[model samples]
Target: MQPQLQQQQQQHVLLQQLQQQQHVLLQQLQQQQQQYVLLQQLQQQQQQHVLLQQLQQQQHVLLQQLQQQQHVLLQQLQQQQHVLLQQLQQQQHVLLQQLQQQQHVLLQQHV
Candidate 1:
């Protein structure tokens, strides 16, 4: 009978040891899960940073295109203004010639 009681006690100790080992394994699994989550967050942040850089690059290119277009438009406007002024000058010269010819004809009639 004493041997039987001793065996039961030994069995209980073994069972307790197994429970402890199981608890340790659960703790390790929880820690691993936490590490995995942190790594995922870091990866997400890196992707966002890359996307932001791409957007900034696109914005810069758009700004350069707008500036180039503005420069071309300004040049065209200057050319158009120059042509208009030249035409106005030519018209004034022709009007002056017509007035002078009319005055000469009137003077001849008066004679």
Candidate 2:
């Protein structure tokens, strides 16, 4: 009866040790899960940051292209205005010559 009691005591101690070990393992597993969740969040934030940078670069390129196009359009408009001014000056000169020639012919007929 004494050996039986000692055996029971040993079994109880082993059971307690096992329960403690299980509790420690559970705590470690919870910590690992939390770490994994944090890692995932960090990775997601990095990806979002990279995407934002790419978008901003694309926008910058588009703005530069638009500005170049505007500059080219302005140059073309300026050229067209110069050409129109030359045409207007030529027309005015021709009209003045015609008026002078008509007046000279009328004066000769009166004489």
Clashes of each: 0, 0
Model 1 TM: 0.81
Off by over 4 Å in 2: 100-111
Candidate 2 per-residue lDDT over residues 1-111, each given as its tens digit: 999999999999999999999999999999999999999999999999999999999999999999999999999999999999999999999999999999999999999
List TM-scores for all candidates, in order.
0.81, 0.82
Model 2 lDDT vs. the true structure? 0.99
Model 1 lDDT tens row, 1-111: 999999999999999999999999999999999999999999999999999999999999999999999999999999999999999999999999999999999999999
Worst 10-residue lDDT window for candidate 2 reads 98-107
Cα shift from native, residue 79, model 1 (Å)? 1.3
lDDT of every model, 2 decimals: 0.99, 0.99
